[model samples]
Target: MHERHTAKARRRRGQRLYLLIVLVLAGGLAWLQISRIHSAAGVVSGQQIAAPKEGFLAPEIQFTGLDGQPHALSEFKGHPIILNFWATWCPPCRGEMPALEAVYKAYAADGLLIIGVNQMEDSGKVSRFQEQFHLTFPIFLDKQGQAGATYRARGLPSSFFIDQKGFIRKIVVGGMNEPLIQGQVSALLGKE
Candidate 1:
């Protein structure tokens, strides 16, 4: 009986240890993405936009808007832009949408552009998601994953804050709360 009990306890411990390890690894990976520990992470192959850091020129992207019209990143150069890469299936992405929309509405008149780049999802599903969130910002389709690949958005809810000069000011890899979004936008708009 003692040996049997001991064997069961060991199995349980092993399982717990495995789970703990997984959680630690996941947290570490998230931290790396958020903190930008990997400096060379966004290397483009054969003309792909290189992974950008703070102060790097925002990538020149070619994307299709939901309106079926083509848009270029350079066209929004004079405005402060929040270029977000997300997917409908990502929980963090879904969680951040409301905050993003709120900030976009609050600063739209101030030339704040929030472009939602849906990663590899169908246009219909993305449109439905936009409607579900009551979002008014323009959503672009990264159908071939070219944009995300260039941006090297290691996490699902990544956002690149671009200043008026078209340089990336910040890169956040996790969900952002409303207040944080507000503060960031305020600063970008020179209000803070």
Candidate 2:
């Protein structure tokens, strides 16, 4: 009985030690992620656009719009544009749609363009999603995912804010809320 009790206590101690190690590792990873976000935040807040090293120019992109018309990014030049790369399946993408639409309505009158780049999804699916959400902003189909690849979007719901000069001013990845979108737009618009 005494030997059995001692073994059980040893096992418990070992389990506790293992849990402690896992927790420490998790905490370290969290800290690293937070630091990275802070660093990225600092980098994009400046006046310069944040885009891939590749030059930003007129790419002959013609994709099916929600209204079935071929659209191109060049037509929206001479205006501040918010280009969002998302998919129909991304929940975070779904969550951020309303906020994007709100901003679009509020700022469209001011030459603010909000373009949704739907990647790797069929035109049918894109149409359904757009209609369901009552999205008034123009959504371009990245059928081949070429543009998204160029941006090196690590995941879904990545966004690029382009100034009127056609320079990318900011790149936002992951999910975003209204405040975040508004703040970035305000920054690009040079508004308080």
Best by lDDT: 1
Per-residue lDDT, model 2, residue 82, is 86
User: Model 2: residues >4 Å from true position, as ranges?
Assistant: 1-62, 67-69
Tens-digit lDDT track of model 2 for 1-192: 999999999999999999999999999999988777555544544424434532243233445676567777778889998888899899999999999999999898889999899998888899899999999998888878887877776689988888787777677788889999999899879997
lDDT of 2: 0.81
Report the Cα lDDT for candidate 1: 0.86
Candidate 2 least-lDDT 10 residues: 53-62
lDDT of 1 by residue, 32-108 (tens): 78976344533311122434777677878888888778888887889999999999999999999999998888889
lDDT of 2 at 165: 72
Q: Alpha-carbon error at 53 in model 1, in Å?
A: 0.7
TM-score of 2: 0.68
| Candidate 1 similarity to native, TM-score | 0.72
